[model samples]
Target: MLFSEAQEAFKKHLIYREMSGETVKGYMKDLRCFNRYMTDVYNGAIYVEDITTDDIEEYMHYLLDERELAPRSRNRYLFSLRSFLNYAVKKQWVEHNVASEVDPVKVMEEKKVALTEEEIDELLATIKHKIVKFSVAFLYYTGMRVNEAHNITFEDIDNERNRLLVNGKGKKQRYIPIAKSLKPHLENYLTNIRGPIDSPYLLATKKTGRLSAGYINYELHRATKELGWDKNVTCHALRRSFATNLLRKRVDVFKISKLLGHSSIKTTTVYLQLNENELQTDIDKL
Candidate 1:
């Protein structure tokens, strides 16, 4: 079977499995270079089933050595190829998935940085725009992704439950309880900052449109420009601050994982990085 034929079948299967369109597109895009390599290096003569472990290793070497791609990026390519070939094996187009046996590039996790409570206050104080301030607050406090915060609607807020509906990655929806401290800020935005806007999005721009992720990121960096933070105050930094603070207060890691819309508790526990107060508290106890 041809690689192109297998590609379309794998894509259809992904769509059938309810994968997001963006995710499907990404998988297909990553495979394009591999397909090109097969055509160019082997003169388009290599059959999909006949492709061997040696062929895969050379491809991995080609990605890291010839292309000089980053490990994280190479891992993505490996993931795409592995998933595709696995699908082909199920269909009997390939006898075995050679790509599945290939190890992907290992991605090293960096030390997570979180904002100080004082630094958070300073950052929020610096944001003079009501909309930007409210947006940043929603991200920092609710532990929502920047896109989730940006695309939130008034209807998504549950006054009775005191939770906000978060549209998370891969089109999953979850509700996170709004903090008591954040409740007033949200109400303030609805009553005063929003100003009877017709736009359904909670964070509307000046023209009464949904705030784009880029615009929110731009405002965040702008606020942090003169603040001299040790780390750049990106959207993820606000999210990190939310998770770390909760962990610092002895909140259940599993609960925090759910609130953050993480599929794995491991992902949420990365924020358990020890702060000065935590280190000192443990040392004193010792």
Candidate 2:
């Protein structure tokens, strides 16, 4: 089968397997770039059977030398191609997945940035957009992924119970405890900012009805730039802050793991990026 035909089949396979829309989009984008490289450099349409391991390696070189993509970004491209080739193999279009033979770029482990409470307060104050403010605050207090937050509806929020029913990854449902400080933030947004919207989503705007991850990131970037902050302050940063703050408060790692809805406690530990002073203070105590 042609690589293009196989790419379409892989896309449908991804969707049918219930992958997130963003995940599918990312995979398709990487595959399309690979397809373009084949057409432009290899001089024509390439069949899945004709693809070689060398072709995949040369593509990686193009991404590194020509496109100047970072190791992490280049790895994403390689992974997408590897996944597509795997799909092609399953469909019997190819004898094997040649993309897998290519070694991925080595990425150094960069520590995640977790916002301090003061920094969180300052960022929130700098954000003039009401929905964006609420969204950031919600992530901080609840430790929810921006996508999980986007999925929230009125029915999911239980004011009386003081918890939220989060539809998490893999369609798993988990209830996140609503912090007392966050109660007012939620109440105010629902009562004022999101007042009587036709959409059922908790973070509805009059223009788009429901908020998108793109808009949230764009607004967040703008706010961070305005504050003259040079760090990578993202939606996931808020969630990391939640985990680290909980750890500082002497919360059990197991409990924090559950709160973050991580399948493993090891994953939660990665988010606990305490500052140097905090590390010193804890060491002194010991």
Candidate 3:
């Protein structure tokens, strides 16, 4: 089949697999770019079976040298191609995914910024919306992604156990211990703020039911701006702060990784941001 035909089929397959609309759109955009390259360079509609690893490798160079795409951006294009070819393989359009044989551009790991505990407190106080305030607090204390915190039901709160049953990425469930500092606020929100809402989610507006991840980040950003702070604080920043604060308290990285529900400890380390003073303090202790 032609690459363009296979591209359309792959798009439908992505949607069928329940990928988000934005994600599917991005994949299609990348695939369309690849198809355009094939059409221009190969001089016609190219069959998927005729494409080889060398062709994909050459395309990577085109993205880098000709298109001047950054390694990270170029890698995204390669990733999109890899996903498409993988789908094509599953559909028996190709014997193998040649795109997989091509190496992605190396990207430097950019350290994520985390808010200090004091900054978190000030930001939470700045948020006027009760739901948004509680959402920020929940993310900071629980180290949950915005979606995971939004998905938390009343049943997920095991108050008797002093921990929460969190449904994390990929439908995986884990328990996170509630900090003593957060318990009072959680209780107040549950008793006074969220009591009237009939929604199952712990974080919900009475009219809208469950709050969206975008809304959560928007409120957090607004709160940060209100504080006259120039930091790029978001819901994910709150989560990073949680990990960083725990590390400051000398918690084991492995334990923190489990609490954050990260698939790898290495992923959890990316969330931790300790300043030079903290590093020196640790070194001094030794």
Candidate 4:
């Protein structure tokens, strides 16, 4: 079958399985890039059967060498292609998934720098946009991903429960405790800045409805620069700060994993790096 033919079917499968809109868009974008590469490299026409393992390797090398994509980014492209090829194999369109045989790009592990509480306060106080200020603080306090926060509605928030029902990654729902510090911000945005909470989404833009992740990141980075913070402060950075601070405050790793909505505790372990004081305390305990 033609790659394009299989691509459409795979897209439908992804949508049917209820992948997030952003995820579906990313897959479509990667597949389109693959199709364009095949046309350029293979003289204009290619099929699923025409693709070989070597071709997959060459394309990865092109991304790493020519495009200078970071190891993680290159691995994501490989993953997208592998998923498509695997779908084709299940449908018997190809004898095997060549992309699957390829190894992922090796990424060196580096400890991510989580923002300090003082930095968080500085960033929030500097944000000129009232809606963005609340949106970012919401992420920092809740440790919710950008997409998960986008899915929140008024009904999802339980003021009495003092928690939020967030539709997290992998279609899982988790409740994050709302601090008393955050209550005023939430109350103000829902009752005033957004005006009537008519759209149901916790955060709304001037265009109406839930704010997009793109807008959140753009405004966050812009606001951080205005505060003279040269570091790349992003939505995820705020989420990381929440988790790291909790760990520093002696929160259980298991509880932190649950709060972060990680599919695995192993993912959460990456953020468990100890500072000098923390290590000294552990040493003293021993």
Question: Which one is best on lDDT?
Answer: 2
Listed in order, each prediction's TM-score against the native is 0.81, 0.91, 0.76, 0.88
**Worst lDDT 10-window in candidate 1:** 224-233
Cα displacement (angstroms), candidate 3, residue 182, comes to 1.6
In lDDT terms, how accurate is model 4?
Answer: 0.85
Runs of candidate 3 with Cα error greater than 4 angstroms are 1-74, 90-92, 95-109
lDDT accuracy of residue 25 in candidate 1: 87
* lDDT of each residue in 1-286, candidate 3, tens digit only: 9888888888888778777566788998998898899889978989999989998898999998999998999999999988888888889989899988888888997667798888888888899989788888888888998778878898998878988999776567899888998888898898888867778888888788888889877887788788888778888888899999999888999999999998899899888899998889889988
**Model 2, range 1-286, lDDT digits (tens) per residue?**
8889888889899989888787899999998999999999878998889889998899999999999999999999999988888888888888888988999998998878888889999999999989889999998999999889998998998878888999877667899989998989988987888777799888878888888878878888998899998887888988999999989888999999998889988888889988889889989987
Error of 4 at 268 (Å): 1.9
Name the top TM-score candidate.
2
**Over 4 Å off in model 4, which ranges?**
16-18, 64-68, 196-198, 227-230
Summarize candidate 4's per-residue lDDT along 96-196 as a digit string, tens digits: 88998899988997656688788888888888888889999899899898888888887998888889998876587888899887888888876778775
For candidate 4, the clash count comes to 0
Query: Alpha carbon lDDT of residue 59, candidate 3?
Result: 91
What RMSD, rounded to one decimal, does every model reach? 3.2, 2.0, 4.5, 2.4
Q: What is the lDDT of residue 52 in candidate 3?
A: 90
RMSD of 2: 2.0
